[model samples]
Target: MFQSTKQTAQTANLTAGGHALPADWLGRIVLIWSGYAVSMFAGNAASYAGIWYATETTGSPLSLALLYVLAFLPMGLLSPFGGVVADKLNRKVIIVVCDALMALTSLALAAWTFIAGPSFAAVALYCAAFGFVSGFRTPAYNATMPLLVPECHLVRINSMDTLLGSISMIAGPALGILLYTSFGLQYVLILGGFGAAAAGVTMLLAVIPRDHGAHEQAGAWASLKEGASTLASQRGLLVLTIGVSLGMLAYGPIDSLMPLMVYDHFGGDGFAASLVAAVMGAGLLVGSVILMAVNPRRKLARIIVVSAFVVGTGALIAGLIPKGGYWAFVVCIGVLAIACAWFNAPLMTLLQKNIPDEKLGRVMGLFTAMNGLAIPAGTALGGLIAEVTGTPLFFQIDGVFILLLAVSIAISKSVRKLDAASSDHPTVEQTL
Candidate 1:
């Protein structure tokens, strides 16, 4: 089922490590996915455990915010350089090395926790280290997808990736609570270490295709500039990227403020907040399943545009909910989550389909960095706005901003042209 018979001649010519495509490529790709699945679960569990530990140890809101920022800041700062490396080096080697380093870091964190009893400083340090390695790992893994799977299957594969991620999100917290309550943070960290090691080993077992001469002559600065130029050269992609980043900015506050919204506005407690979160997660899972079943191959830009509109409307409605309308708010949150789930797969597929493989890493890296930076910035801004106008009012404003952004994207001729452009199947040498 993973195999695609519709590979164009141009796509079929793509090679892995100077060798022809192997018959067992599907099996190899599945192995890579399996490794990632293990890591995702472990990483999520470790994050939950660490956050709980922090809450118990310091019980400071500022400390929790700092911990969250530390997790994303390094990745935001380092992703561009990591992308340069992904384009220049063997991507498989990058993945393997980063995963191995993460494994070692997790092991070290476990040992430290066992001895030091889970201080705030140690957890913060561990978060920074994990984010640092992930900055490198993410781009390589994203760029490697097209090399392993046929172009026709990109949407399905991307959907599957999101599906697994959603599963990890839903289940990881449960595992973290169980492990933390029963065994402690040390065991959770140990599990994380093993997960990372498993991911590294799977990458080692897989055969990943790479362009041997792509960006080989360019220095890091030159390559970085090229990635930027490549992004700017395509007006549609540039607009799309900006729009997505803005969407993240609008939506990011919801994550930070959801519990508060429940408490302050809806007059609900922690259980209600947790229920809302669980329902939203289920919405994401449902969206992934639908996308996988549909395997949309056309009008991806339209899908994105519509999804943004749905999310904006959902948020606006959510903000308008009265104190007694907790169920209504929960339903809106689910709808928003479903729309948000639709965003990634189509967008990533568009990038993979259009961006030349040689330059995909740097472009993906920059994309990741922008997105990573946007959420925290949005959260900070949202907090300020919420403090002033209140949580519901802030959501109302965020929703309006996003709705306008969606309309602007829909009206843009450049973005509308992306559908036709993606169908052309340009060769890797083509820029933009």
Candidate 2:
């Protein structure tokens, strides 16, 4: 039987590490997440529109590849510093200011596109700028989670966050196309601006708790090294991070290659590609909902390993689909997306449970930076490979690489030991 909302809230308050939660903590989280979701939806819409613009304008694989590289590279470079700032500053202020900047950026892009007409340069510039700002926002926002929610509800809230992102993925492309075809790119950008503004305002209205202690005593370089040492001190976590980073290096290009796969391999149009993306989003939504309902608190590492195998299998199958098998490809995409959701939620829960609150921002920032670097490198490599062998063959290679990576992780004693202990009561060593 499921506990009622009131009972769940009361239990959460009672078990919150000897700290009593505010009476309306749940409500506050809901309000903040809701606003963030709106921002994500609009931002995604604008992003897709920009992607489509690039696709139609250049029709080159390298252009698509460069888009992701430009978007993520700055964030990758800046995230460590961003993490240090997150640990040392007011997180709420960071989020609000970043959101406001994003809103203004969007509005400015809209105006520029309206005047100069759409260009790849403009899209690239926007991607670069957005990525830069997100470097600061991502670590701060992620670190704030443990402060707001109790340990027991961490998985649920993380799942909910991913679920909301899935929803944005499902709708963003559709809305982007509609607005792009009907009004113009300017309108899409304008909508994104409004959504970002709304997020900032809602965050302003909500009350968020501060970090347990001040981190301003340490210098920036020292703080960064401390965060890095903290992560390295945990053998299992260090191994896990390295493994995931390698996997992402192989898997990251899939996002950039999807439209090309649909167009070049399946002879499909923009709408078909969007349909496939939407199906993938649905798969993510299903996975997140299941995780939210079940709230599994144990064997998180095992879950990630199994999910990786499923994802690899799905990708392999998708790559093997025959021409005129677009629906089959879509089905495979959905399956992999579900597996991805499962993989992500558990990984995040494990980190949140194991890392102390004070250092979480820096650690997450470092993690994000690694991923950010790996993704662009992968995308660039994948683009070069796709140009020679076609997208289908690239997908097969990616899948095989991931499968091997997963097998390696599964056999490793260190990673498997991650699931041996109860995460509810992490030891001092684990937190350090």
Candidate 3:
């Protein structure tokens, strides 16, 4: 499963080349990270503009629902294949190609919208293409992590990811709104295209190893089956996957409805939505910083379970707040956001450490696919429940359900035994 504390320390002392890491290891990663940050920020900006445009133009729930489906469905459907591609192809090439393709498609959409005027179809098409590429891009990107850094630095690096994402969430939407209002959706789309393209070009400078095992003769179905088997081979990983997948059901509604909750329950305005998001982003940044500094190496299973419980507690408190308690709701959201880093970063590090590099892409792809599917299903279920009961009731029930799930994971002998199962095992090493 995972390396013991001692083994991790031993591995951390060696670089991907089995020699000591250069003094500039952190600097090298930062160089790569800067490119990603720019690209993601621009992508988020485009997405926000599209959503806002659709809301203003169509005002149809059906159209909005379609946009949501398009956003997630491609990833859900194509992730397995993407995972196979990641495992068998040069990951750097895959990343660059995905970024380039996405940029081109976005540019084409911008042209179409500029010529024909904004249409739901154009936005939906862009979202679909972007999502499709992301299915592949995300797996490769994640799989590349172990290649770039020592095992001990995984937590800190992943936390950096969380921190960047938080900054994007806080800044992207506001920037998108401003650009859209001042200029237009076309400009926003062009901005996104350039951003992605720049990232692709910049990524070319990074030196990454090719996948040697990818040449093995295997059909797509065979590759998928192999990936599935790899995941099933590890009981702790299997359980962890299932637990987190189910947990997405609890998260879907919260993600899709958070703005609505603020607007309806707390009598929030447009600024209030941004305010809540900023608070949550700040909380995530703080949590990420703490994890980066602490870099917890022991009792990961316990941390995951406990963080999940904290998340549930935050949700429960949010739901229980009296009407007009805006500040209280914000605090709960902050707590939920902070707990999110704890719940996710550790599990991600564990998977990266334990899984073989060749199989990492497939495993990450499967995880993304499962979680992607769960989100839309959960969103629909949560929406229906909210309609029947209330938003507050939905949050409360989701919290309780998550708490139960966490307790189940905590009490499981398999999960509890994970810590002791940690051993010094030889792992295939690669680098970027």
Candidate 4:
């Protein structure tokens, strides 16, 4: 059932890592999905445990800010190099190595924390290492997806990715808190380490295709330049990149302000804020599930445009709700989260289909760096705006900007033509 007869022996013979394509392609995908899901859960859990420990131990805003900086700084610094490595080297090896490094780093930190008790320095060190590794890991893993799954199912696979990620985010924090409270920070950290190790081992067993005509022999700077050139030359991709970055910037502050919005605007406590956050997560989970099941493979552009509008509208509605309208806020946030799943899944699929596998790592890495920069900048600006005009005003203004961005994308000839163009020039499927 997995390998249809129409996919003849020649296609089946085109192997990943010199091995024949598995008969049960579906089963292989399931295994890969399970491994990554565990890794995501562990990573999120460890992050929460570290942050909670830092907050409880230091109780210093500066220390928390430092923690945040450590979490992101390495990724910003190493992303370009990561992209180069991903394109130049065996992607599967990079994945295994990065995951293993993260596992080892987490384990060492767990031991240190256990021996000396929790310290901000130890946690910071672990975060920095993990972040550095992630810079390399993310693109390699993403680039591997097309190799494992057929293009026809890419949207469904991407939706499932978001679904599992939302589930991990929702459960990871609670698990971290539970483990930390019941056992200790050390145990939580150890759990994260085990999760990473398991993910690495699992992927190690899964075959990935070698790079075809990759710019491996070229100088790193030249390769980087080529990746940049690819993005610059592709009008549709360039438009999508700019639009997504701006959207991230516009919405960045909302991520950090949800709890504040619940508490200050609705006169609610931490528990109530948690409930709102949970509802948003639940919404994402639901949206992902539907996308995965329905697996819409057409009208990708319209979906993206409509979803972006929904996201902006949801944010605007959240801000417009009157004081004490807690349920209204929850509903708005839920819609926003659902729209996010729709916004992200097809967008990722579109990029994957358009970009060549040889350059995907570099493109994704550059994109990640751009997103990283935009989000923090937007977050800082949002904070300043909120301080001056209040959170609701900031949200309202941000919403308008996002809505405008979506309208522009909807009208853009390039964006409207992306999916159809992508389909006409299909990527060569890598079988394993």
The lDDT for every candidate, in the order shown, is 0.79, 0.83, 0.78, 0.76
Between candidates 1 and 2, the one scoring higher on TM-score is 2
- Model 2 per-residue lDDT tens digits across residues 1-432: 123444544555642323467778799998998898999899888888888888778877889999999888888888898999999999899999999998999899999999998778878887887788888888888888777778788888888877988999899988988898788888999988988998999899999887443846898899899999999988888777877877778777888888878887899887887888788789989999988988888788887888889888887888899889999899899989987888666777778778887888889889878887888888899899988888888899899988998999899898877878755444333333
TM-score of 1: 0.87
Clashes of each: 0, 0, 0, 2
Order of quality (TM-score): 2, 3, 1, 4
Residue 20 in candidate 4 has what lDDT? 46
Q: Comparing candidate 1 with candidate 3, which one achieves the higher TM-score?
A: 3
N/CA/C clash count, model 2: 0
**Which pairs of residues clash in candidate 4, taking residues 3 or more apart in a chain or in different chains?**
21-432, 22-432
Cα deviation of 248, candidate 3, in Å: 1.9
* TM-score of model 2 (CA atoms): 0.93
The TM-score of candidate 3 is 0.89
- Estimated TM-score per prediction? 0.87, 0.93, 0.89, 0.85
Q: Can you tell me which runs of candidate 1 are displaced by over 4 Å?
A: 1-20, 52-64, 181-183, 213-215, 259-275, 322-327, 422-432
Candidate 1 structure quality by residue, lDDT tens digits, 304-397: 8999999999988888988899999988988888887888889888888767878888999998888777776777677777777888888889
Give me the runs in candidate 4 sitting further than 4 Å from their true place: 1-22, 49-69, 115-126, 211-215, 263-273, 420-432
On TM-score, the candidate that comes out on top is 2
Summarize candidate 4's per-residue lDDT along 126-163 as a digit string, tens digits: 77887688788877777777777666678888788788
Best lDDT among the predictions, by candidate number: 2
Order of quality (lDDT)? 2, 1, 3, 4
